[model samples]
Every structure is written in C-alpha cells, then in structure tokens.
Target: MANIIKKIKRKHKKKKLQAERAKMEQSRQNRTPEDAYQERLSKHRSAVIRRAVMTVVAVAAVATLFFFYMEKRSYHNYKILSASEQEDVVATNYAEMSGKILRYSPDGASLVSDTMDTYWSTLYEMQNPVADVRDDRAVIADQDGTLLEMFDKDGETGSVTTSYNIIKARVSSSGMVAAILDGGDATWINFYGSDGTLIAENQTHLADPGYPLDVAVSDSGDIMMVAYQFVDGSETTSYVAFYNFGDVGQSEDDRIVSGYTYDGVVIPQIMYLDGNRSAAIRDDGFTLYKGSQIPKEVETIKVDKEIVSTFYDDNIIGLVFKNGDKDKPYTMRGYSTDGSLKFEKKFNIPYTTIKASGGNILLYNSSQISVMNSRGVEKYSGTVDGTISDFIKTGWNRYLLVLDNGVDVIKLS
Candidate 1:
C-alpha cells in the first residue's frame, strides 16, 4: 500500500510540471509581435553591453601595460622634432623663458620660439654682458661697466646709464631693476623702473652697515634684499636686510621692513625665492625668510659638509654636498621653503648645471644628462652626441638639446 501511494505522488508532481510547461508555451504562442521583439531586444542589449565592457577592460589593460613599459625602458636615443640654425653656444647665452629660449649676446638679444620664430630681438653692445632673469623680465648689465639693458617677452623695455660701474645686477618679475654700483669708498644700491628712470638710491659704506655682497629684488618688484658683510673687532659679521618699496614701508627709515644680522658667518648670496619668501645663502649653511609685509627668519639649515652646488625654484630648494661615500661621492638634497627635506639622492655624475623643476632634479654636463624624480629614482641617464650648452625638458620624454651646432628638439625612445 505504501509503495502504491508513493508512485501516485510522483505521477502527480510530474503532471503538474508538464501542465506549467504547456501553459508557458501557450502564452508564448498567443503573445503579440511587439512582446516577442521586446524580449529579443532585451537579450541583444545585454549581450552588446557585455561586449562593450569587455572591450573597455581590454583597452585599459593595454594602456596600463604600455605606460609601465615606457616608464621602465631605458632611453638611449632621441627623435628630433625640429632643428634651428646653428648658433655658437659661446656667442649666445640661452635662458628658458615662458617655454621659449632667450638668446642674448654682447651684440644683441632675441627671444625665439621652439618653431624657430623670433618673438622679439634688439641690438646692444657691451664688453662683458651678464643676464639676470626674474619671470618674464631680464636685465643684462655690463660688469665693471655702466651700460644696463632690460628686456621682456615683447621686446626691449629700457636702458640705463649708471654713473658707477655695476658690480652685480638683478631684475624683478614685474620689470624692476636693481644694481649694485661701485662708489669710491662705498657701495650704491640703485633701484630703477623698467622705463630706465631712477626710483631710489642708497649708499652703504664698509665702515658703516657694511659692504653689500649681493642684491636681489622680489618678484613683485616691491621688496629688495641685500646681503652685507662687515668686519667688527676681530670677528666678521653679516647682515641680511629687507627693504620694502610698498606703502607699508614708507614710514620706516629707508623703507626698511625687516633685517637680520649674523656674527662670524658670511652670507654672500641672497635671493628672493618668490614674492613671499627669500633665501640668504651663507658660507656654512642657508637661511630662509618669509613674509610679505614684514620679513622674518623662518628656518635655517646648517650643513657640516661643504656644499658643492645649489639650485632652487619657487617650490624647491636644492643643495649638493660632497659626500664621504667613495662610490657615490655627491649627495643631492631637496628641501621645501619650510625646511622640510623632500629627497636625498646619491649620484656620481660630474654635473655642470643642477636644476630642480616640476619636482624632478635635472643634472647635465657637456655631454651626459641625468634626470631623477621626486622619489630619488633615476628615470633617465643618457648621453648626447654633441656639446650641450643647455638641456631643457620640454615635455614627457622630450628635451631641447641646445648644442653648439643647433637646437635639437628630441624625444626619448
């Protein structure tokens, strides 16, 4: 009896499943053409979406692989995009300005584009010409001479005839010119507009506040920094003076906003890192100052090892020291304006110019060039066939190799 009942239950379950299947088939047969088309369209749409997703994933994977390959591959050659006429590197001093090259000589100066078009050019004469650039403005002065010429991105702005010989000269971003002039028993700091008009002049004697070692104007063309060195008693001391030409400094004596004095330490080099920051490069170490209205000392980094070379931009301050390590004898360090160390890289290249730009350290000599990223990873170390006066990074894997022969715009491959 139990076996018969189990067989009956199984037959009922099978009949129910068969009836549901027949009902579903009848529903499909009675359906409208629109319904059937909708069903097919839905399935087709899902299939198309899946294929699109798969293709996107494959393309992304390929792009990632290509990026890694390019990053890791060692570049040994370059492809020149354009070439300029051959200009002797000695006759022309080239400086990068707004993605173009400022080619200047004792005879003249011109700002030329990468496509071999001259933006502007002017003729001048000097026995010894020295150029100092700040932003788009540049001041080219004749050392031990009185001729001072100024330029901008457009063309020649002004020319000044100094009464005293110019020991050193600097230009601000807004086209303010400052010159250290030689006096008979003193030094004169003369400030001038880009229009060749004298704005102000201050004289310093060695027996007084001291001899101005170096002078730098702020990018805003409002502040001036002078590093003065003097001997008092048996110890030699230095003073880092900051003067403001803005309205905030009008009431103060000589427009003095802030100043610092150092005893027994010589600060021969001073510069305005930006509008709000300044640096006084001392013989032993370096000091950074900050402020717009009143300049004050923010940080000082002391160095035990002798600094071999130093370079900086608005964002980074770099120092290269002679390391004690025999294998890697050069230690390159980068710091922010707050005195925080960013990177410490070890290299052995006998570099001529060390430049920090866009978070990469670029070092190059006459033939060899090396590039290291912010993480101290050497991305490129290669050589060019010609004598390189300037190796400028134009873009990713691209450089402007300013050789003695011509300008070779190249891409790393």
Candidate 2:
C-alpha cells in the first residue's frame, strides 16, 4: 500500500511538471513568431517610408527646375533692345536744395539717385532755378540772365547765351533751342547746336514791332517761328518763318523753305507741337500735316471744348478736352490723320498726373498708375508706395519712378 501510494504521488508530480513545461513551450512559441513578424513588418514599413520620401523629394526638385525654366523663358521673351538700336533716352534730375541739375542716359538708369551730386556735369549753385526742360537740355534763368544748357550722358556743353530774355524756351526733338529774344533794333533769333555752336541766325526787319513767341523745329530740320504780328500789321497774323542751318548766314537761295501760315492767336505750346511731325495742335483745333504744302490738303479736326492734354504719335493725335468746369468731368477724343474724329470717351477718375509714350499712356491719380494703350484699352495698373512725384518711360515697358525717399525703375511682366 505504501509503494502504490508513493508511485501515485510521483505520477501526479510528473504530470504537473509536464503541464508546466508544455505551458512554457507554448508561450515561447507564441512570443518567437510574434517577434519575427514584428521585425519583418518594421523593415517593410521603413522601406515604404523611405520610398515615399524619395519620391516626394524628386517631384519637388522637378517642380523647382520647371519653375526656374519658366521664369527664365519669360525674362528672355520680354527683353528689350538697347536704344542705340533705334532711339535714345535722356534723363534729367533736379536738386531742389542745391538748385543744381543732373543729366544721364536712360540706359544707365542706376546712376540717377541721391548721390547724383557726385556725377553731375555742371555743378554751379543756381540762384533762381530750372524753369523748363526739353530736347536734351534745361533752360536755367537767374537774376543775371537766362541761358540754354544742353546736357548729354557725360556732362554739359558751354551754355548758349541769348540776347533776348526768354519768357518761354522751346526745344525741338532734333535739339534745336528757340526762345523769345528781346524785340529791338538789335533783337534777333538764332538756333544753336548741342555744342553751343551757332547754327542759324534770323533778324526780322518788320514794319511793326513783331516778336516770335513760340518756335518749332521739325525732324526734317525745318525751323518754324510763329510770330504774333505781321509786318503789314493789318490782321493779327501768325507768321510761320522757316530757316535752314545747312546754309548759315547765307542769301535767299540758301534759306530754309518757308511755308504758309495757319493764322490765329494760338499760343504755341512749343514742346508738344514740335516733337511729332505728323500732328499739330492749335488750341481746340488739331490738324494733321501730311507733309503736303497744300493748305487745303491739311486735315483739320474741331472739338467742342478746350484742350487740356494732347498726345501725338506717328499715326494719331489724342486730345483730352475739358468737358465742363474743373468741378465737372472731362472727356478724351481720338482723331485720325484725315481730320476725322474717331472715338470719344469720358473719365470719371481725373488723372492728377499724366504722361504719354508712343501710343502708350500712363495716368496717375494718387494711389495707382493706370496704363492704357492707344486703342484706349486698360492694360495693367499697379499700386505705388507713398507719393509718386514724377515718372518717365525708360524701355519698351519699363518706367523710372521718382519716389519721396528714393527712385526705382520698375519693369512689368
């Protein structure tokens, strides 16, 4: 009985130990499979993540390259040729404090700045101030007298001293300077070159005391002087006398071709009338001179109101006429070369400042500068900082803007 009892106890202990070993083996099997699966899953996930990151980086690099390529293409497309290819640009700077003048080429646009004092041509402390600028020069007057100074990209040539105290100075695009000289026994008029060399001198032996108030020099090198009174003194005739510089101080055969007079009391706005040859404006009436000497062939355009601003190109002459008083609105009219009125439009927004280039027009009210084409289509306008005192066109679509603190040249895309 004791042996049987001991055997049974040993069998029960063996069974218990077998059960414990089986449970430990089962737990180890389960843990080892799970650990292997987890490690494999972690490696797979890392590979997937690395692939995704690389794909994203590659896409971003391609996009960046495409963006730079587009930018470079656009830049090349809108590039403008230098003025030496066609036309030249003349820039002017006024030093308000020192009362001096600075001039430079439009190509070297970076040169005009507060440091202009270091690069100006004539560095004299002016007493009065520069009254007007035209052609490639400025008319500076002081208590001593008035002098016409021509400036290039480098500096100024010697000034052309006029005997007549010029009430108004007008310069042609061809660089001809005309002023209202003193009317007396010794009073006369003359045109000077950019180097202050006398080109042509004209003295009028008028039966009456007649003085030329305004003058126009054409691109073909024809000088037209609009005198208020004629020698006969009957009708208040505006004399259009033409002079030639090719024959300086010569006889009648060497004189310039004199054309017929378009008579009126129209004060010659010399700068606007002279620069463009195909167009002419006399107050409310605008005419297109088609290079024909016949007076009847000239196209005459009549407007209902007085003219405010006039823009002339090779094809058309755009006139801004005041519709009503200053409190009322204004209208702009476009006229053709055949004296035909083409289009008339009204602007509710009065342009406080206006500038024209070729057929492109720019109007600045206060906050924005509106750009418009010759067809009266609004192109694109942009906002400016502070007050824009003045701005001028540089290249085909670039502008040199004068700000309060500094000057910036903006190129639009």
Candidate 3:
C-alpha cells in the first residue's frame, strides 16, 4: 500500500510538470515572429508621426510670430501730420518749375504761387475740364478731348482745336502735346510742338496696327509712342510702336522706328521717361524701352500678383497690388525706368489716387493722405480735416490739400 501511494504521488507531480510545459508552449505560439515584428513597426511608426507633427506645429508658430512682428513694425513707423480745412476745389496740380499750385474747375483754371496768391485765372467754355500739369506747363482740355488750352504761371501759352473729338491727351514737360483723336473709321495720333504746331500725325487703322489705346510724346516732341490693341478671334494682341520724326528715324520705314508686339496683353498706359527712355504699363506687367532714335526693349517685368492700380510720372512707375494678407491690404511697388525694382512697401489704406513725383510718391483720397519716398518708405501719414476734393504736390515734402471749403498747404518733412 506504501509503494502504490508513492507511485501515485510521482504521477501527480509528472502531470503537474506536463501542464506547466504545455502552457509555456501555448504562450510562445500566440506571440508569433510576424506578430512581434508588426508590433515593433507600429510603435516605431507612431513615434515618427508624433515627431513630424510636433515639428510642423513649431514651424507654423514661428511663422505666425514673425508676421505679427512685421505688422507691428510697419504700424510703428507710420506718422501723422497736422490737419487743415479747404473747400471748392475741383482739380489741383503742382508746377515744380515755378513753385506754384494750379487749381482748376469747369469754370476756369487758376495758377497760385507759394504764398497762396492767385497768379492768374483764365476762363474758357469748358463743359468738363481735365488738367495735366508738368514741370513747366499745364494743359487743360475738355473731357471730350476737343478743346485743349495750355497755360503757364504767367498766363495762357497756347491752344489747340482738334477736328475730331479727343479721347485722351498728354503734355510733355516742355509743353509738347500728344492727343489721341477718335476718327470715324480709324484713329489718329497727333503730336504737337510746344507752340501748338502739328509736328507729326499717324493714322491707325483697325486692320493694320489696330486702334491706339494710349499715346505718349517725348519731352522735345521728336518721338511718339503709341500702344495699339487689336483682337483676332479670341486672342488679343498689343503693339507698342515708336514713331520718330527726327533725323535719326530717317532710314526707318514711314518713320516707324521700332516696335514690340505682345500676345495676350493689353497696355493702356505709356509714358516717356525722357527723350530716349519710355515705359508701357500693361495688365500683366510693364516693359521698359531705351534708345535714341527708337525705343529698344531694355527689360520686361512680369508681375505674379493681380495688379489693383497703377501710377506713373515722368520718372517712376508705381504699381499697387493686393498683398494676400488681411492685415496689410495693399502693397505699393515702384520700378525705375530701367525696369529695376526701386521700392516695395505694404499699406493698410485704400488709396483712391497715387502719384509719383520726383523723389516721392503721394497717395491720397477724400480724407487720408500718405507720402512716401521712392524707396517705398512712408514719410508721413495724415488726415485732411475736411472732405478733400483734390490735392497737388507743392514741394518735395509739401502738398496743397484742397478741401471742399478751401485749400491748405500741408508740409510733411
């Protein structure tokens, strides 16, 4: 009976050992090699994804902080000048040569000196008067482009009567005038000397170079640039042609010195920087031309952003575009005649008009005015107390603010 009991105890112990071994094998089988590898890979992938997400968040936070700092800097640099009130100003312009201010209305035009004294006022039969002021002369033409009268600080200089209605007119610094006339079946680009003598005329037809969209004359009245636009089916083409009446263009065909044709461009504004330099502003961008006899293509600037507005004077071309930011509404960019970017700046104000003078730019509306240098640096920002009708630059750092009641000279240094 003792031997049997001992054998039973040994059997029980063996069964217990077997059960333990089976459980260990089952646990090893459940954790397979493929399952272990997959588990390790999932942990590693999760860690990598978490690191990537943290890096992105850090970068975004830095970018947002940088933009906020830049906006604060811009606001801190802005300034406000003194305010004044003015009234009954229809149009205003500044003559840099004589240091005088020109105020015009439908009734007449007046030239005022720096002392606010009216030098002269000339009355004409003007239904809608449009004035263009340069350094030495000012030209007031009817909105219809027909009756054009030139004036100086002294008095009326010359007048030109057009046979066809005038669509647009521009005067050079020396009083040379170029007018685009609306002919019946065609259009005419007429160039006149300072004394209102017809210098040259080019009749543009729809079939040849198309209609003249814009015209510009040289300071000496020796060259004329015309922007001609034509449509062929769904495609639109623009041609900027240089016409020279001087001896340098004698060898060219019909005085057509040089021209550039662009597809899918519509250039509505062209101006001569000087006798040899000219620029044409289009929807896409602007082209700078330089030559003696004819304008040679110097550089072509292509703008990526949508252009909101454009302003040009004798020397600088200014373009205002949306900045794609809510804090800064617009960006003003100035380019030189050689197609070099001179300055770029962002502003919050929505300017109604922009003008580039010698070394400065003037931006104004009915209530606000901003002055900036050629380098896109804001020099001053101020408000006109009363409702502003028109304003003109009296000096490099001065503006004749025309209010609804009177005119105030604002000096911003």
Candidate 4:
C-alpha cells in the first residue's frame, strides 16, 4: 500500500509532538495565583540573595579578622585587678574625675573611687597645689595662693578667693574661672564666677598685651585663651588672644574676638580643642583656631626638633622628640587640631609622664609603663607598681594606678 502510507505518516508526526508537550506541561502545572506567587517570589528572592551574600561575606570575614587581631596584638603584662585600700598616696596629686580619683594636696581636695571610694573631701589651703580637670568639672588651684576650689563629680561646687596672687587657675566645664592675676607690674586676667563672682577683668601689660604666658578655658563656660610673652626690642614676642564671653563677644573690646602675633615664637600653650578647635602650643609650631564664635587662624605647624614632651587630650596633640635614634629614644608626634598629621611614633619610653587619653598613648615613668594607640599600635609594654602617680584610663585596658602604693586597678594582660 505505499509502505503502509509511509509508516502512518511517521506515526502521525510523533503524535503531534507528544501533543504539544502535554500542552506545555499543562501550562506548567496550571500555576496561576499570580503564577504561583511569581514562582514563590522568584524562589524567595533567590534565598534572600543567598543569605545576603553569605552575610556580607561573614561580616567581612569577621571584620578582617578583627583588624588583624588588633594589628598584631601586643601587651606584655599587668594584672592587679583591684587593690584599693592601703592609703597614703604620698605627695598625693592624681587627677581624672569622671572616672573618679582626684586626690589633691597642698592640704586637701578629694574625689575618689575606682575601688578607692571617698567621693568628696574638700578642705583647702593650697599654697602650691594645682589641678584642672574640665569635663566633670574640677579646679583645685592656688599656685601663688589666692585660693580656688571647685569640684563636680558630686561635691564642693564652688569656692574662690582672689585679689591678686594666683598666677594660674583655669576651670570650665561649667564651673567657670580663668584667673592669672599677679598685678605686680600689671598682669591681671581674672574672670571668675563659680561663686566668688567677678566675671571679667583684664589688665595685661609688659608694655601692651603681653605677659600671660598660658591660660586656657573653654569647655563652654564661654571662650578664653591667652598666651602672651612680650619683649619686642631685643626680639621675643608671642601672641594669641581670644575672649568671647558669649553674646558673640559683646561688641568686641575686652571680649576681644581674635588675635595672632608671633614675632619670636614662645606661645607657651593654649588649648580648647574637642571640636570647634583652638590650640596654640608653640615654640616652633602649633596654632590652630577655627571658630565657634570668632576663632579664626586655622593652622600653623612648624616643629623640627626639641619638643621633649607635650601629650594632650581633647583628642590628641602629643609631640615628644629627641630620637637621635639611640634605639628609638623617643619621637612621638601626633597632631590633629587642624594641623593634621596623626602619628609618627618611635618610642623607647623613658617617659616621665605623658598622656593622650582615650585613644591611648600613655608613656609613664614612676616605674615604667608604655602604651600606644593613636594607630601607631604598641598597646602596652608593661612594668608598673607604686610611684606611678597617675595612669587613669579606668576601663578598656583598665587602669587607675595612681600609686605611691595605693590604687592599682589594672588589667592589660
């Protein structure tokens, strides 16, 4: 018959392509509740994008393995976890309120606890005592004696008695006072008011706007910074003044708005930088001043050598040099109040006392203790016990060592 009609016309075209692939798999199993919820929301968005790319690559591989194990960890030793109770901190002077422990001397001043307890012990006579805390307020003065005592970690909030003869007194975290009076050849700066009120007075002169040498107050008790030192004819001038008792500097005269002059360097140190800048510390370099109300100057770094030691806090401004490299005999340089440069580091630690606070960099010496952390790493080299005088970080690597045999509270292991 024609070969059986060519095998039934090739089996009727293979049963019409298996009946159109079973009607396209029955229209894909008849799905249509919005296509089975858009195929289960596209397989639940591909399993939540594969668990968010495996949880962002496992939290960036555990933050790059905890930043290379805190940049190659280092902490030699230390473990006095607590030991406050033996008394007699010798010439007693520690300072670091807000983390407790103030302990002054020229007769009295106290605010302790970091295991040492005793949060208030006022009694002043201070012939040469000196302190200046800032954030939780603290100002135990009396350099040449005219009295001053203000505390605030909960106790003794005010007391001042001036009439000239307190060549230095600065406190402002709300217990305002900015004294520097000793008007013998005219040089009174007075600005008190923590309850001995006298808000403003200026009578400086070494032949016009000079001799203030160092005075800084600005923790929002409303601006002030002076660093004079004058002697023009044989050269040796220094300047830096800015006073603004808030009100945008009441029409500008004694509330002087801005200033800057440095014919021969000598800026003795002027600070107020925790953000809205104001620093001056010079003798070759350091001058930042950026407004919160007429601050201006901005930047001035010069330094070449001979810094010896400076250490600050308001978030760093260190500076210590003398590294003729006798095995890294010291060269710590760190800056940030606008002059940039954050770390140079090269320590050997013979430090007599250095501190930078919070970002670390505490090189001590009353029995050695070197730490480093403004990203120069070197977190602790250890050796501590007694005579430490003050290391007070209080938490992280823990420390409150102010000793002469008293409060230990360490933990740098």
Global local distance difference test of model 2: 0.53
Q: Model 1, range 150-186, lDDT digits (tens) per residue? A: 9889988999999999999999999999999998888
241-358: candidate 4 lDDT, tens digit per residue: 8899989999988888888888978878787875367788787768788877788886788887888778677767878878688887877778776677877868677778887766
lDDT of candidate 3 over 1-413, digit per residue (tens): 99999999999999999999999888778998988899899999999999999999999999999866543332222212433334345454334445676767766777866456777888877777777766667777786757888876687888888888888888877788888888889888888776778887778898789889888777776787889999977889999998888898888886888989999999988888876788999898899988867678988999988888998766688899987889998988888777788878788977788876646677888888777666677766777577766666666456666677666665553
* Model 1, backbone clash pairs (residues 3+ apart or across chains), number: 0
Estimated TM-score per prediction? Answer: 0.80, 0.58, 0.75, 0.32
Report every candidate's CA lDDT. Answer: 0.85, 0.53, 0.77, 0.80
Residue-wise C-alpha lDDT for candidate 2, range 1-413, written one tens digit per residue:
99999999999999999999999888767787778788799999999999999999999999999866643432211222211112122233432111222333322111133323344435444333343444344434332345556554345554676666545555554555655566466446666665667776666555433556556555434544444445344555444444544444145443644444555435344323333244445665664543412112256566667778876544456788777656548687766556567667776555777655535677776556766666555555667765565655654566555555555555666
- Stretches of candidate 2 off by over 4 Å are 1-120, 125-144, 172-174, 182-188, 203-209, 220-222, 225-237, 247-256, 262-267, 270-279, 290-297, 313-315, 324-328, 336-343, 365-368, 381-383
Best-fitting candidate, scored by lDDT: 1
As for lDDT, the candidate ahead, 2 or 3, is 3
Tell me, by TM-score, which candidate is best. Answer: 1
**TM accuracy, model 4:** 0.32
Between candidates 2 and 4, name the one with more favorable TM-score: 2
